[model samples]
Target: MTASLEAKAGIRRHAPAASRHAYVTLVTNDDYARGATALTHSLRHSGTQADIIVLHTPALGEASREALAALGCRLVEADLLPLSDAFNARHARRALHGAAPFTKGRKPDFHTPLDNFVKLRLWQLVEYESCIFVDADAIVLKNIDRLFAYPEFSAAPNVYESLRDFQRLNSGVFVARPALATFAAMQERLDVADAFWPRTDQTFLQTFFPQWHGLPVTFNMLQYVWFTMPDLWDWKSIQVLHFQYEKPWETNHPKSEVLMPLIALWQAFHDGGPIPDIAALPGPSGPAAALSPSAGA
Candidate 1:
């Protein structure tokens, strides 16, 4: 067997053997509060035994902070200082801009998954032995305890392999070890100077850990295909469902109806009277309406 084969086997062997604590981190910016809120409730409802936290930029005002605080999670400010250490001020600012892509426009600012990738490193710094980073747009359908069965590099592959322009991995969900050195080494490869610089975080990661394979597709089901895979609907097969395109609150989402469970959970817990009307969602071409009433108004 080749060295890569030996290493893969070794990593797999260590995956189930390591006993560790698991926590979930949802990284967001101001605009994605609804998705973040829904995710918190979904994870809590599933009785995830791990600590849950939100990582948002410092610009979030007191009212928003207090609101997220009410969810009973430890709110962490993904501030400037640490990022300054990893990247220069200009790059840090660019990274900050990337993290909150929901702001400014319906589309994300950067072409790469840098936001999620950076948050993954940020979560590692916070001291969780093993951490699961879920996008704010995702909801947990079942206890994903077995995800901990894998080691530092685990994720789901993109449905279209040809889309791997630079071999970018999927950013929706992943699990990793807290070993900073391993990640730092990965960052070195992401050296802001690479000629074939990754357009997204996953691409950089794909290059960093060439040996990383993805988890079974069932774990990170893409919402776009609920109709395509209805026959494969073992709800238990899905641990975290990614709301990739049209979020539950977005207008004209062909599949927002599919997120009824999440919408119901949001209504039951949030003091906000009722979820927005599905009819109010933009009809596919228009921009997504904001979750906050002011934005909607």
Candidate 2:
């Protein structure tokens, strides 16, 4: 889908030198458009003061593009990432479902946008001193603008813990400082096949920012946490719901019925309505009482 001339120009100038830190996400097509739509909606409802932006590639169909523009959030056009399977940032999320996700995924399409690499592209947005990248597959449960106070490379740990010792932080949510140098550094290392752990950008980020500050577990609540450790996450206490699996969009998803409320909630944002602004979000909730070592750190 082609962006309108006005939107195309607006995308180029959306980030002003005076702008402060902001929230960003990506949308590739109808599937992710739905998620991005809801995400922006929740952000507004939760009272986020920072600018909201949607970074998208040409693969986004015309309808999706116009729909997002109608949301009034800035739309920045991102080039398709050159790396293989790097176009879509959802690979790691898909891997969370099972070793083979093809069976459950949408029918293969001819055009696959480069989404994963866009994560690195965030560094190219030099105008903002900092940014919070919330995966579109999530919804904000409360105002999380206070997270802007944290330093760069801050993120929550992946909710899934394997029998193996290795546990990568979920890129579903993160705070980063966008810089050209960091973007260049990532590109230089992309050629190394082993650069990305488990063949996804989540690991590349972990390797690049090994000393990243940690956000509270409540910042990005994954579906698996509710499935595997319910006590650790209280919906009333959480900030965002990272739709780890069984997304609200898929009619047959196991969590579809229970998570159905999220649809109307997302729609309210998509359709337009009043929501709390940044100043009114619930009191900053602390991490769970028994946060994992990586989580509470």
Candidate 3:
């Protein structure tokens, strides 16, 4: 078998056995490929021993794939979910955005609603016993290997603006087990007639596992909490910082001024520079300066 095939089959040429757990992230384009690179750097910086896996679509260029491979990230080519044409049409860029506009923050032009559903392909990776799926736009602040012990379908609540926002789960970071049965089950419920997922994979995953275990918010701390809920912004406790809406890579985006501090943090990881002390990083001025009234997916 080829080297890539052997790795997928859990038969590494050097190691006695491949790690049963891995950190998985997705990249569809060059923008997200940059995010994935930084995420891998941060994961290595945190001293994680598990494998780093980057699942990319065909849209990603060869340069991006080579960059990720240089960082010791196992590359897997993931295809968009095989849904009916009607389902894909419903979630197309313009259609989904028109039906459910993002009033709080501007989603970058490259953000495709259908690309989000590709996350579900993680389930098809049955080679790994367990996996922690973190969004490409997020960086690991601390070693979170302990998350592997957490049960399947465990994710942090979507809390950014207020306590009331905890009603839903955030798929930005979650622990899941790899099982073909589960993958098949998700496909069964994903594309029924008139079936619509407003938040794409986030909504569908939440529905697929209604009784999902709730991880502490610190595990997947959303960037908005820095301003909207400053009281909850404990840098020392945050394990992962997720740039949920406005990515740090964008130049002079709408919320650039407000998110400069967080953006700087992401840049440090992306550039492989000396990371600043998390505890010493300044917090928001106050809750009064809350930028957006609503939370994003």
**TM-score of every candidate relative to the true structure:** 0.64, 0.74, 0.91
Which candidate ranks first by lDDT, i.e. highest?
Answer: 3
Best by TM-score: 3
Question: What would the TM-score be for candidate 2 when compared with the true structure?
Answer: 0.74
Clashes of each: 7, 5, 0
Assess candidate 3 and give its lDDT: 0.86
Question: Superposing all C-alpha atoms, what RMSD in Å does each candidate have to the true structure?
Answer: 10.8, 7.7, 3.8
> What lDDT tens digits, residue by residue, belong to model 2 across residues 1-297?
124652432234333443587898977667888888888888877777787878877677889878877776677777655555442333445542344343322322321323565667777777787899998888887888877778888898776433231245778899988887887788777645433344356767888888877777788876555434645656567788787645566665544433344444455565567543423332213322233333311
Instruction: Residues 148-167, candidate 3: write the lDDT tens digits.
Output: 99999999999987899787
Residue pairs that clash (backbone atoms under 3 angstroms), model 1: 112-199, 112-200, 113-200, 113-201, 251-281, 251-282, 252-282
lDDT of 1 by residue, 49-160 (tens): 7766666654556676677778766665553222324444323435644543333123332222334444544433335677777777776766786676677678777542
On lDDT, the stronger of 1 and 3 is: 3
For all candidates in order, the CA lDDT equals: 0.53, 0.65, 0.86
